[model samples]
Target: MQVTALYRHPIKSHGRECLDAVTLVTGQTIPWDRTWAVTHEASKADAAETAWVACHNFMIGTRTPALAGIWAKLDEVERRVTLTHQDLEELTFCPDDPEDVAEFLNWVAPLCPENRACPTGIVTAGTRGMTDSDYPSVSLMNVASHRAIEQAISGPLELERWRGNIWIDGAAEWEEFGWLGRDIQIGEATLRLREPIERCAHTSANPRTGQRDADTLGTLESDFGHQDFGIYAEVVNGGEIRIGDKAVLQ
Candidate 1:
């Protein structure tokens, strides 16, 4: 197998950016992956309080599908994120500047219905209301797993549905399934495979159009024989990873 594709989500549940290649840094979060989120100031939900923003406290797939088509890229310096639609001009925004980030949030808020439900906003790294508990601020996936999912679905499955921070394609199909509790090398970076990522209603939500399909979960169970898919990994060593980078299972 070969590394076929790479991706990252700048804002949780907002949009995804495809990469020709990427570099993995040890102890450094993946570029633009969940670096920002929307949350609301008032809600009876378990963790609601503070300035309310849409993606901050909630998940994306269930309500917005076009989010799957959105893509992003981090400037080589890792200070700015550039947003893109499939064939549209890329819009660059700074994560460090609150004003700039807010502008971008307002720009895309209208694109999603969830944004309409509540006043939408953006939160970047170190911001008070972004991220989920246990999230390392970055996530990775194996291309092999994508292939397996595609085969099981018997159709073209878009990468945005997974919203992983990194994508590697040099391992056997579902090879990551064997990586639980192990360490693997991707390019110059070493990562510890933590555990199997559990599926949630989020998966059933189409990232491309924001429509929830009740069949997504059922399809995964019937075809893959398990509701589980993909492995979560933590960075063990910092380094740069590029497309076609050698991935060595240690």
Candidate 2:
């Protein structure tokens, strides 16, 4: 197989950014992926949390589908994040600044439903990312499998809906499931496939329109016998991985 794409979401449930390449670190999530999360008024996460916590404490795309359409760019040097939406003004601010966090919540509030808890603040878990899995993870996807899903549902869905870190091509449909508990080498990095990532309602939302436009879970249950789309992998060896690199089952 071959690596086809790379991505990182600086803030969880906010936006996604494409990367040409990245350096993988052993036992860590992809760099800058899910570096921060917007905590809601009803969230139980403490702003001072020093370790990773469950994703339920954050204001996620699952709660507000519109957030799936938001786009983001991070200026790593200045630690500034820029968020843009079709209906909102461009926002640029450092996530570490309290004032900036407040501004971010206010800017994103309009997209949130009134019945749901409002976004309150931003929080981080030190150097580790707040992945959906309890363990630090890098999500991988198979393009052929995505195609199979679309074929099953008789509809096309954007890959962005998956929000995966690495996307590989030339794999058989659903063949990634066979890699579970096996080590795969991508470029110079070796990763152990952990488990299939369970599907979520957040994926039903169209990433381009921020609208609930698909029934991904429904189709999975009826056609695939399960609600899972991707696999989570733990980095076992640190190395730089780039687009177009070879991916081999090891």
The global C-alpha lDDT for each of the candidates, from Candidate 1 onward, is 0.61, 0.91
lDDT of 1 by residue, 75-161 (tens): 747567777665345678875576885777665665566553453445554433233435463455777777777776677666657
Report the number of the highest-TM-score candidate.
2
Task: State model 1's lDDT.
Answer: 0.61
Model 2, 1-250: lDDT tens per residue? 9999999999999999999999999999999999998887677776644477788889898879999988889999898999988888999998889998878888998999998888888988856999999999999999999999999889888889999999999999999999999999999999999899998899999887799999999999999999999999999998999999999999
Evaluated against the true structure, the overall lDDT of model 2 is: 0.91
Best candidate (score: lDDT) = 2
The residue pairs in collision within model 2 are none
Show the lowest summed lDDT stretch of 10 residues, model 2.
41-50
